[model samples]
Target: MKKSITILFCVLLSIPSFAQKTEIIVIGNIHQPVPNYNSDTILTILKSIKPDFLLQEIDSSFFNDDFTFKNPPKENEGLASVQYIHNNPKTKMRPFDFEGRNEYRKINGFNPTEGLAIKLLDSLYKKNKLTKSEAAIYKKYNDLLEPLKIAASKDAKSFNNSSNDKICEERQYYQYHKLLSIMQERSEFSNTYYTKANGEKISYLKGFQLASEFWDLRNQTMAKNILHIAEENPGKRIVVLTGFMHRYFIVRELQKQTENNTNIIIREFYN
Candidate 1:
């Protein structure tokens, strides 16, 4: 009887926990549709990883095939990969990102956040609201940014069967952030307060700040949504496909989350 008790105790200790261990894979991606990378590449890898749920950097509420037609990178690598996964009858689709421009609009309360700085500044220029020198500086900065944007667009294969999340994190860490820094520095409108033709003074910094807040808040919301997914679907293997810029912050947030009833395993997808 003592020997039996010992065997049973050992078996009990070896059994996996009932709460379920959740595996989360976050992939950083380039937004452009580079021809070298295609649906087959993504599909093959995802087929192996076999996630129970796949998340995207799209508005939670936005429905099928509507906005992509309006956007240039619509059929880009990220969305294409998502579409391939979602199209498979086997993969479950989950909404991850907050509502797009509307999310920012709601937060700022009577201000625009969706690239409004560039638009407003350009509009002001067309209407002769900005000085020639101001417009020139903005244009110059945009010109300087073209090369960086192209480099990021071409980095579609940064993630593959061999690399982990950290590899992707580091790759994008340089390219994406360098673009952001250039963008911010070029936003001279942020500091220079100018009067409209109507005599009301406006600062482009207001728009820049609101836009920045929108992005930061969106990231936080995304992390919270992941936590909710963990609680609702315990033991699920989830893969998040978002812009490379988001990888580091989301990974940091997920690391900070600790749950008693669920075990979380974070990794980069590997075949």
Candidate 2:
């Protein structure tokens, strides 16, 4: 029995240790009438990279929804986009699958447009019926965002570059994340998330404080997701397409996971 146990132990020890391998690529601002050149450029780049998996910033839940609905025409544009890509012979040459980072899921929850946060906020307001002050505050928040909304509606490119546009959108993004962070911190619900700062809370009473905290936290979450994915998929190459600001964070996270090993490659696609 002792001899047999020793042999089994040796075999188990020799089974080869696994190390996850992944590559992270960042794509910045790919919207517009910049002609087909930009898309073609991206197509060429993707072809050369030939990544096994293609993770987008889009919410995975949405992707699952598209899959469930058999690519319904109106409800989901992303699915159509994916189908378009996959059907093309030249660009669709690889067996890439769609996945999303934690950031995408988290943001999807917060989006004031057709997301959980807006629904909850509406419910809460309706339940309490919102005191005049509370209603006023909410209205103010909406009003603050109106200018950017109009700008975005008129000319997307101009709005994308406008300082107010960034502030307004980032404000919404931060608030959304902060709300999630608060929920997570409070440990009340599962879908509601807190920011990366672990125990931080977002108090609705204090207009934008929570959002500011959570915005930074989103950066951390993005980094964590990138690193976690890389570590979990040892020896397999994975690619992530996220916001440009996240590129450095993902690279740093990967470096830490690899123990400063220089084997990991990093590239940026932007102006």
Candidate 3:
């Protein structure tokens, strides 16, 4: 009996013990205040989640040494987070946006127009610059995505849900990855030149590719920051509030972390 007891103790000591998994909810937020999905709506979500740490999509430089906004964040998520932190003094808010984000954007002359490649294609078609085949491709992509956009825009709640998250993911994937490739393959956009927001002229293909790469890098950085927070505070709940456009990228990146660590769980706001 004593020998058996000693062997069992040794076996127990050799086994690795796992820490409690940290719960992370990545909530998709709207930048501007919509009818139902305004600051108040986000505030309510923060209240319900009651996260120990709130990972905001705010650039580090945007915060003061004490973590208060330096010049007041422009996004609705930032606004709501401020109010939540005021109420829940214990909950900490951390900026997780990519460092040098503004400078990079400025240097790259990055503008929102880069994301409107589809709209640009449609304009080209209307202007009779694109061939019939190119026009048909644009029309097909637009028709498929328009209803989803319409449905998401109808209400703020509808826009932030998982359904909208999926739509946003699909839309971005097609916009940045598939659409450009299809157009190039069809020889539709090869000769096109797009004037960037900063008035620099570049091929439509290169401009979209650069924008896509930057977007992926930014989301990857955000995910890395969130993972660091989760690892440091084991078993705590962390809520990531970011624009709906970034929700899919950040969540997908975090999900990859779960596979190796097994100490992180990615969840949706509704879940």
Candidate 4:
């Protein structure tokens, strides 16, 4: 009878572990204040969530020994997160951005390719040389972005919803995947060369490919960091504060982990 009671007690003790789920909220945030969404808006959202952990979109290397930003940006969501942590002393703030990201961008000359691609596209458009299909794709991409741009200018909540997330994903699809496809179809765009800082002449297509890879890798690393924290904490609530553009990628990656039986429940701030 004593053995039976001991077994029952052990089962009771383990019930909470099985019953509790790790809740994760991914918030799409703006770096600078818009018409309605400012630092106060971000701070309010953080307080409402009351998260046990706040995963900020800041590289770990950027933090000083005292947990403040060594070289802070003019204005960003991370600053608001610091404010939240100050008020809620129990909530832990962590940096989930990819380390050495700046170094990678500098070494790879990531910005030149995109700038050149846009210039080529603009030249094509101005000269009426763009194929009908290419023009249509660009128009659709811009149209999709218009709503986001409008929402960002006025309504903070509208800009951060699932609708906007889907729009952003579509925008990325056209911008990265579809645009690359178009660029590769024409030798004019693909074969164009840009001189890197290191004096190496790389094709525009290759440079864009490298930039896309880096973007994906950075998001993957950030998602992995969030997942690790969720697994370690088990039932704790974690809020991921990231730029609106990165929300889709991080959420997609986290969803993949959920499919593999990770005990995480992803939620939006509104939900």
Clashes within 3 Å, all models in order: 0, 10, 0, 0
Candidate number with greatest TM-score: 4
Q: Write the per-residue lDDT of candidate 4 for residues 89-134, one digit (tens) a residue.
A: 8888778888877777767876677768867876776788879998
| Candidate 3 TM-score over all chains jointly | 0.80
Top candidate on lDDT is 4
Error of 3 at 56 (Å): 1.4
User: For residues 16-90, could you state the per-residue lDDT of candidate 2 as single tens digits?
Assistant: 332333455543333332442244444555555665444554443544533332334231223323544574423
Worst 10 residues of 3 by lDDT: 109-118
The CA lDDT of each predicted structure is 0.59, 0.44, 0.75, 0.81
Q: Please identify model 2 stretches exceeding 4 Å from their true place.
A: 1-21, 31-33, 36-38, 65-205, 256-263, 268-271
How well does model 2 score by local distance difference test?
A: 0.44
Candidate 1 per-residue C-alpha lDDT over 31-129 given as tens digits, one digit per residue, 9 for 90 to 100? 555565554555666767778777767764554553222232254444544565556656666667875656445445324322445566566657775
| Residue-pair clash count for candidate 2 | 10
Kindly list the per-residue Cα lDDT of model 3 for residues 77-192, writing each as its tens digit.
Answer: 88888889888888888889999887775456444435555566767768977766666666666665785657646654666566776787877776677667655664435555
Which 10 consecutive residues of model 2 have the lowest summed lDDT?
89-98
Q: What ranking emerges by TM-score with the best candidate at the front? A: 4, 3, 1, 2
The residue pairs that clash in candidate 4, if any, are none
Estimate candidate 1's alpha-carbon lDDT, on a 0 to 1 scale.
0.59
Return the TM-score for candidate 1, rounded to 2 decimals.
Answer: 0.60
